[model samples]
Target: MPRSPLALAALATVAVPGLDAYDVRRPAQPGTDYDVAVVIDAHRRRWVVRAPAGAAAGAALEAEVEVLDALAEHTASGALPFAVPQPVGFAHLPEGGRAAVHAEIPGTPLRVDALQPGPGLAADLGRALAALHELPTSLVENAGLPVYEATEYRQRRQAEVDEAARTGKVPPALLRRWEELLEDVAMWRFRPTVVHGDLTAERVLVADGRVSGILGWGDTVVADPADDLSWLLVAASPEAADSVMEAYQLRRTELTDPHLQRRALLAGELALARWLLYGVRSGNTEVVEDAVAMLEDLDEHTRSLDAESSATYA
Candidate 1:
């Protein structure tokens, strides 16, 4: 088997010329077990290195490799359009097991600056995501990866909440929100599409006014395309998000599912809950702090949704 993504991220950080002096940091948010190092090169080239840690260490590494392989297969077969991580030399760590070097794509993460909905950026990104979703469903089915319907996703979170309760990892406020959100997600239904599993602004790389790279394929899975679209919607302003959805609809007409918006909201909550879990387990302060904010936002949204659903029927 090839080297894991966690190993690749570590090696990539160390191998980059003149980046050795910068302090390596942990994940800046909650429910994330990845160790992130922000390095500035001698010429002031900034890059980030993220490796999985704790029990997540080995599984994350392996998952990243699988994601790359899946991307390669899809890209070669003309089913996918994004550039995936290419692994170089790797190391074997006792804790994380394997670390490999990844070719650094040139671009800044999308979340760093204020995002404007340009004429084509949103459409381009949305369509690109759609292409990934358009892959052969049977192939993914054969792989036995978890397919996250909204209910399934919520159930997983409930399971996590139960785990947290047993372990004393979650606070009462967050746990209540988790329960409320799970109830809301149970009523949702959308057709399945391949999801990025970990869709966020940080994972998207943009350059020269366009999206140049989409990074972090470790969380790839088959699920609702709305899960992937949620990032674009959440990160962009409403107008920008609308433009993006319009562009996406033009390229991949299948994105017109009625349940799109609902699933998007659910996905965001799920992401927040996940980060919270990561923070608790890894003891990352930033992750824990962010999880609090995420819990609040998710709580409000879930309540709004529940009210809206009740109003619609009445």
Candidate 2:
């Protein structure tokens, strides 16, 4: 069961010495693996407190803290464009984990569906992505984060698809399509960068028409930049996605990687395979069925598009 707001507030007091909460409440969305709460201290300053639910979550929390510390150290000379969570204090949880407090970063998470095709929210997201990808690879390396070259990244993705295929739950058409996409070696050529590996609308915060903060850095890694853009495919409209990509391309310091968008599309498709594998491993039949259905839908959609293209050319 998720912890109560009162209990979490008490824990927050313990985490931050001499801090007295004036009020406390549940966050907008409670986390699955962490008991989280928003607390307002005596001076009316907002803070977020989170406690891990298990060993794995605890380890992830520790890793995130280390990475945040490394990032702060590396960016001491003012490199980052937005705020990242930094643990202000910590306390051991009684149930065999730990809780940490962080001052609440400004702004709510971006509403991606509302993004439009202009120099608006989508452009801000594009700029945010460019800023993150522009960060030095040494920052992630110094934090002991995972790093992967293009070939290695492709191989890992191929391995994941192989694992998903073994489950026999994924649609055969979708599997074949993914296999072909993965085998296209020419599309895999792009420079790796330090990416916020688990980027989604929820992790992106916007305030005053710009990205103000990024939350949850546990999945930070040096890998394919296209993987970061894949989330936009699912969340934003096509026109908005196009605007975001155009802005991203304009801001990038490197020469154009012509295949980046195609790779991003492939990455978005592969996410379904990953979900199916997770469901099969965890014995979640409902989720497995859902993933299979989605994959089938994507297969049908792709086939229709291909047929239309062939007809148009003829």
Candidate 3:
């Protein structure tokens, strides 16, 4: 069961000594493993309180706290342009779990569809992502976060594709397309970089039309940078994506992979497969049905494109 906002507020008071009173309210719908709320103290200072849904999530929360601490202490001087959550306090729950408080980052979540095609905000977001990717891998490594080589990451993705295939639900054409991409050795060649492993649009925050903050660091890892770029390819408009890529390329110090955009697109496509697998594994029939509907839609779209190409050639 999830903890109430009021309950989390009480926990915040205990965790962060010096809060005589505060108002707590749910900020957004809870994620799979957390119940999140915003707490406004008597002095009008704001903070985010996150309580774990289970023991495994509690462990992840602790790990996130550690990562935030490391970033605050080690990387503050050369910090990226945007803000990351600062770990301020922690508390032990009555149910023997744990909760944490982070200084509130001031911004609303990015809504890609609502954005128009221009260099301003899009470029800022790209540059911010570049900064994050360019961060020294040592920070994550020393903090004991998951690190992987390009080949290793590809192997993991292949394994997931294989597992999804075994479920006997993924469409044959989609499976074949995914397998071909996975087996293309040249396509998988790239240096691993620090990545915000679960970088959906919602995790990116905007203020005054620029990226002001990034949230949800629990999946931080040293892995394929394409994972970080995948969301933008799907969510951002073509002109906006072009601007973003231009800024990202200009900002990056290291050699950018030529096939990075291709792989990012592939990653975006595979996300649906992962969603399907997750729904099946969790025994959520509704989710599974939804994923199936998406798969069918993808199949129709792919077929239409193929027909158009063949007609053009003829």
Candidate 4:
């Protein structure tokens, strides 16, 4: 059962300091692992409270708090253009777990499908992503986050594909395609950098035609930067994606990786495989069936494109 917003608010008042009066309400839809709410104090200061939904979620929340705490101190120099949420307080829940409160960040999450590229929002997102990827690797390392080299990351992805294949649910063609991509060593040779490992469209916040803030820092790591670009490639319009990639290349300090775009596309394609694996592991039949249906649709689409290309050449 889900926890009540008012009950969470009552917990927040006790956890947070000097909060005499406040209004609490559900924020966006609850995340898979947590329930979140917005708390507005009498002074109009806003804070977000998040509570874990399970034991695994509890551990993840703790890690997120640590990462946010580290970033808050690390970014004091104001090197980045966007804002990152800062942890303000914590509470011990009656259910024998922990909850956290973060200072509310400005701006609302961008809807990728509805975005209009004319306002330069795409470029703003690009620049923001570049800045995040370019952050010094020491920050992630110092925070005790996971770091993966090119080879190790590729191997991990291959392992996931293999795991999915073992379930016998993934289409053989999709499995073959993913295997071929993962084995292409030439395409995997890019320097690892700091990455927001779980950058979804909802994680980005926009205001005034600019990326005002980025949320959900729990998955920060040192890994292939292409992982960060996958969501944009898969979700945004072609024109918007092109605009973002152009801006990202212009803002990036280092030479652009030759196969970055290809790897990013591959990452997007493999996301379904990951989802399927997650569902199987979690014993969620609905999620597993949904992923299988998506994979079948993708296989049909790929065949249609192949036929079209062959006819064009003929």
Which stretches in model 4 have alpha-carbon errors above 4 Å? 73-75, 95-97
Could you tell me the lDDT of residue 57 within candidate 4?
85
Count backbone clashes in candidate 3.
Answer: 0
C-alpha RMSD between model 3 and the true structure: 1.6
Model 2: lDDT of residue 288 = 92
Error of 2 at 174 (Å): 2.0
Candidate 2 per-residue lDDT, tens place, 113-134, comes to 8888899878878877887898
The 10-residue segment of model 3 with minimum total lDDT is 70-79
Provide the lDDT at 217 for model 2.
Answer: 90
Candidate 1 lDDT, 107-196, residue by residue in tens: 766762375575766666767777777776655555556666656755665787676555454556556755665676434555667777
User: Of 2 and 4, which scores higher on TM-score?
Assistant: 2
User: Which digits, one per residue and each the tens of the lDDT, describe model 4 over residues 1-314?
Assistant: 77788877766787787875468888875677888888888998888888888998887777777777766754676667888888677889777778888778898888898755643888878888888888888888877889999999999999988998999998888788888888889999999998988888788888887888888888889999999999998889998888888888888999879999999988887899989988999999999999999999988887898789999999
Relative to the true structure, how large is the alpha-carbon lDDT of every model? 0.63, 0.87, 0.86, 0.85
Worst 10 residues of 1 by lDDT: 22-31
Please list the residue runs of candidate 2 whose C-alpha ends up more than 4 Å from where it truly belongs after superposition. Answer: 73-78
Considering only N, C-alpha and C atoms within 3 Å, which residue pairs clash in candidate 3? none
- Give me the overall lDDT of model 1: 0.63
Which RMSD values do the candidates have, in order?
A: 6.8, 1.5, 1.6, 1.8
Comparison by lDDT, 1 against 2, better one = 2
